[model samples]
Target chain A: AQTVTQSQPEMSVQEAETVTLSCTYDTSENNYYLFWYKQPPSRQMILVIRQEAYKQQNATENRFSVNFQKAAKSFSLKISDSQLGDTAMYFCALSGGSYIPTFGRGTSLIVHP
Target chain B: GAGVSQSPSNKVTEKGKDVELRCDPISGHTALYWYRQSLGQGLEFLIYFQGNSAPDKSGLPSDRFSAERTGGSVSTLTIQRTQQEDSAVYLCASSIPKGLAALPSYNEQFFGPGTRLTVL
Candidate 1:
């Protein structure tokens, strides 16, 4: 079984600033997938970025990027030039051999304009 | 085209009543998933369906929480004897077949807007 953990429950950042949300996971499987999802007040979940365990390079999408340390079992999301619209609940997840993604308790991010 | 879609965006039911949530996955996507998110919490996997194979139900919290996907496209989650704890946002997601290719994109899941269930 895979388990994901998000240590921070809440975080705030000013517009144009950068913030990083921490995530850690444990899995016995060597091959897996990691993801960061953003849920806004509208209750819509939008995929931010994803990292494949087999990949040595990090994953980035626009202003969102992930620092994945496979050896440490850590995957953290970095949001650059944050905007008020970036305020949302962020969840980190891992999918292993079972193909089922296990999510961590989310971190609520508030981007202040 | 359309992303995964869910119906009855909001549902309020009595504690003993049963409520059914619906989901329509993207076209041609062979993998579907059900998840629950309580207030101020992360998502909890509920069930998963892939093609005609038997679903993975290990994540279902209890027997009262059951789901079925018909015709490999639409899915319904039924909660029998709903309890107040059952009140939460139920999310649906669909992705391409996991093993279709070795590409990581195949595992990307597109999600629905989610249905908020409130048990009174």
Candidate 2:
């Protein structure tokens, strides 16, 4: 079984600043996928970015990027030029060929003016 | 519409009562999934529906939980004799067979607003 862990339970950043949330996972499977999801006050899970275990290069989506260290089993999310809209509860998840996902507890992000 | 839609966005029921939650997947999507998010906890997979095949109910927590997909479209999750521990937000998602690459593979998932259930 795969397990995802998010060490940071809360994070705060000023508007236009940057912030990073830490994540780690335990997996024996060589082929897999890592993801970060954001849940705003609206309570909808929104995908931030995803990294393929086979890719050496990190995954980036506009203002959101990830630092994926396969060996260390570390996948962290970085939000650059953060906006107020970025304030949300973020979750890390792991999956492979199987569609089922194992998610981390979550990290609550707060972007203040 | 364009995104996944779930019915009765919020449901409150007394313990021992039965409750049902519905999900309408996006058009053309062959796979649908159900997950539960307990307060302050991460998502826990409940069940998965792939095409017309019988759903994968491996994640169901107990015999009281069951689900069915109709005509390969809408799906409903039912909890018989609901318990207080059943309180949580039920989320629904759908995707194509090849995975997210068609979704641009961002490993993205189109999620519904979720049905928040409170068992009293």
Candidate 3:
């Protein structure tokens, strides 16, 4: 079984600043995918970014990027130029060749102006 | 384009009653998933459906829960003899079916707003 862990329960970032949320997972499978999802006040889950385990290069989506260290079983998300809209509950997930994904306990992020 | 949608954004039921939550995935998406989010359990996958393959119910917490995807599109998660602990936000997600040559990005699962179920 694969387990994802998000050590931080809550995080805060000043407007226009940057914030990095940590995530780690335990999986025996070699082929897998990692993802970061955001859920806002509307309670809609949105995909932030994704990283393939085979790709050592980190995944970047504009302000959202991931630092994926396969050897260390770590995948952290970095939000640059954070805005008020970035304030939401972030979740880290792991999915191997299967159709289901295991999610971590979300981290509530607050962007303070 | 319309995104994934779930009906009855909110539902309230009494203990021992049965409840059904529906999910309408994005058009053309061949994969659909059900998840439960609560204060104690956080987020947990309940079931998954991909194309014509057998749905995965490994994450379901108990036998009281069951789900079915109709015509490979809409899915319904049913909970029998609902308990107070079953109260939570039920979320649904969908993605393109994974093929032998499918890219990782194409497998991204888009989620619905979710249904908040309260069992009192």
Highest lDDT model number: 1
Looking at candidate 1 chain A, the ten consecutive residues that score lowest on lDDT are: A93-102
Candidate 3 chain B: minimum summed lDDT over ten consecutive residues — where? B97-106
DockQ of each: 0.57, 0.54, 0.56
Clashing pairs in 2: B100-B103, B100-B105, B101-B104, B101-B105
lDDT of 3 by residue, B20-109 (tens): 999999999888888999973557888878789898788899999999999989899999999999999999998885677663234688
Give the TM-score comparing model 3 with the true structure, all chains together: 0.94
Query: On residues A48-103, what C-alpha lDDT tens digit does candidate 1 reach at each position?
Result: 88898999999999999999999999999999999999999999988887667788
Interface RMSD of candidate 2, in Å, is: 3.0
Looking at model 1, the pairs that clash are none
- Runs with alpha carbons beyond 4 Å of true place in candidate 1: B98-106
In order, candidate lDDTs are 0.90, 0.89, 0.89
Residue A14 in candidate 1 has what lDDT? Answer: 96
lDDT of 3 by residue, A12-71 (tens): 999999999999999988888999999998778899998989998999999999999888
Q: Provide the lDDT at A39 for model 2.
A: 93
In terms of TM-score, how similar is model 2 to the real structure?
Answer: 0.94
Displacement of the residue A47 alpha carbon in candidate 2, Å:
1.2
Point to the candidate with the largest DockQ.
Answer: 1
* Residue lDDT tens for model 2, A3-103: 99998988999999999999999988878889899999877788888898999999999999999999899999999999999999999988865767789
